[model samples]
Target: MTKNKIEKIFKILSKQISNPKTELTYKNPYTFLVSVVLSAQATDKSVNASTVKLFKIIKRPEEMIKLGETKLKKYIKTIGLYNSKAKNIINLSKILFEKHNGKIPSDFNLLTSLPGVGNKTASVYQNEILNIPRVAVDTHVFRVSNRIGLVKTKNPDETQIKLESIIPKKWLKSAHHLLILHGRYTCKSQKPLCGDCVVYKHCSYIKSEQNKKNISSQ
Candidate 1:
């Protein structure tokens, strides 16, 4: 995509989603970390449904440690891979309390060092909790970015690098949320709502589809 088109894509999206934020509900960084961990292979809706009551009771790392893995599993059992997620949450909570003074570290290295917290999770936390400008390349972001021709990466890591390099510095903080929302709501995986898309005029996927249709009709 040209720099101007790239800028316009974000401009239109920002106007559409004025108050973009993580859909996962959380009381604080500790809860946000736990929610992100549970969100692996699970939806934000699912994580929020379970964490709604859990966040009310346990608001800190120490509180999560007290809840124990078994009870934590019970709370997040509705989520995918509850057994493993519960264990990682319990272990990471213990580490955070013991080493980091029950605080979510702002440092990317330390955040990713936590169990179940990978590059994507750390980026999301940094973007949302730490107010950092990072592009967390989730499934939605990867698909949307490539389909829109902003990037043509095969993996999330490449997509993250390409997006950060090309995306406007001012839009960095909100770009992650915008791309995710676009993919989740409009530019879906199986079938994108091209008619409703604001940037469809600049969409390579849409143009390619049109080309294919014209050729087939001929």
Candidate 2:
């Protein structure tokens, strides 16, 4: 896409989503990191539901480690892969407490070194906490960016690189949340609500579907 079109697409999305931010709830950086880890392959709603009580008592890495993986699993049992998530959370907490002095590291490499914190999680933590401009590619971001012709990549890592390079720097900070919210509400995986989509005019998926319909009806 042309630079002007990309700029326009973000502008429209910004207008549509007045306050684009993570839906996950947490009290501090430590809690936010844990929430992000637990959110892998899970909904924000589910993470929030689980973290409501969990975060109330566990605000630091030490607290999380003390909570133990067994108790952590009880809190997040409803979420998928809670077994592994709980283990990772406890393990990461131990690393943070023992190695990082119980503080979440600002360095991307150090953050990713923690268990359960991958590229997307590290990017998200840095972006939200450290005020870094990073476009973290989750499922929603990957799907929406590809569907709207933002980037034609097969994986999240490639999509992130392409989007960060192509998108205007001014919009990079909010792009992650904007695309996620848009995909969650309008441009869904199944039965997308094209009529309600603010950027439908710029969506390649919509245009492609229209062309297919026209061809079939001809």
Candidate 3:
């Protein structure tokens, strides 16, 4: 898509989504990182459900390390892959406590070096906690960007790279949350609510479907 169209789409999205932010609940950076880590294959709602009580007790890496893996499992057991998520959270907490003096690293590479933090997780942490402009391509972002023709990519990594490069700098900070909210509520994988979508006119998926319907009618 052209830059002008992309800008218009984002402008409409920005207007529609007045407050574009992460839904995951956390009190501090440590809890936010843990929330992001636990949210790998889980929904933000699920992560928040499990972390509600857990965050009250564990605010820092040292506190999380003290909680240990076995006890941590009990807290987040409702989430998918909880066993591995617990282990990684505990291990990463330990690393943070020992190496970084119990503070989440501002460096992207340092954050990615943690046990469960990958490209998406690290990008999210940087964008949210460190005030960085990063398009963390989760399932929602990947699907929405492609469907909108903002990017034509095969994988999340490629999608992230392209989105970060193409999205306007002014909108880059909130783009991640904007796209996620759009996908979660409107441009869903099954039976998308195209009629209610703010960017419906700019969506490649909608345009293609309309073309198909017109062809069929003829």
Local distance difference test, each candidate? 0.94, 0.93, 0.93
Residue 129 displacement in candidate 3 (angstroms): 0.7
Return the candidate ranking by TM-score, descending: 2, 1, 3
Report the C-alpha lDDT of model 1 over 70-174, residue by residue, as the tens digit: 899899899999999999999999999999999989999999999999999999999999889999999999999999999999999999999999999989999
Rate residue 121 of model 2 by lDDT: 99
Model 1 bad stretches (over 4 Å): none
How accurate locally is residue 83 in candidate 1, as Cα lDDT from 0 to 100?
A: 97
- For candidate 2, lDDT tens digit of each residue in 1-218? 99999999999999989999999998988889989999999999999999999888889988878889898899999999999999999999899889988998898999888899999999999888888999999999999999999999999999999999999999999999999999999889988899988998999999999999999999
Kindly give the stretch of ten consecutive residues in candidate 1 with the minimal lDDT sum: 25-34
Q: What is the C-alpha RMSD of each candidate to the true structure, in Å?
A: 0.8, 0.8, 0.9
Q: What stretches of model 3 exceed 4 Å from their correct place?
A: none
* lDDT minimum window of 10 residues, candidate 2: 61-70
Better of 1 and 2 by lDDT: 1
RMSD over all Cα atoms, model 3:
0.9
In model 3, the worst 10-residue window by lDDT is 198-207
Q: Residue 178 of candidate 3: its Cα lDDT? A: 97
Q: Model 2: runs farther than 4 Å from truth?
A: none
lDDT for position 163 in model 3: 94
Per-prediction TM-score: 0.98, 0.98, 0.98
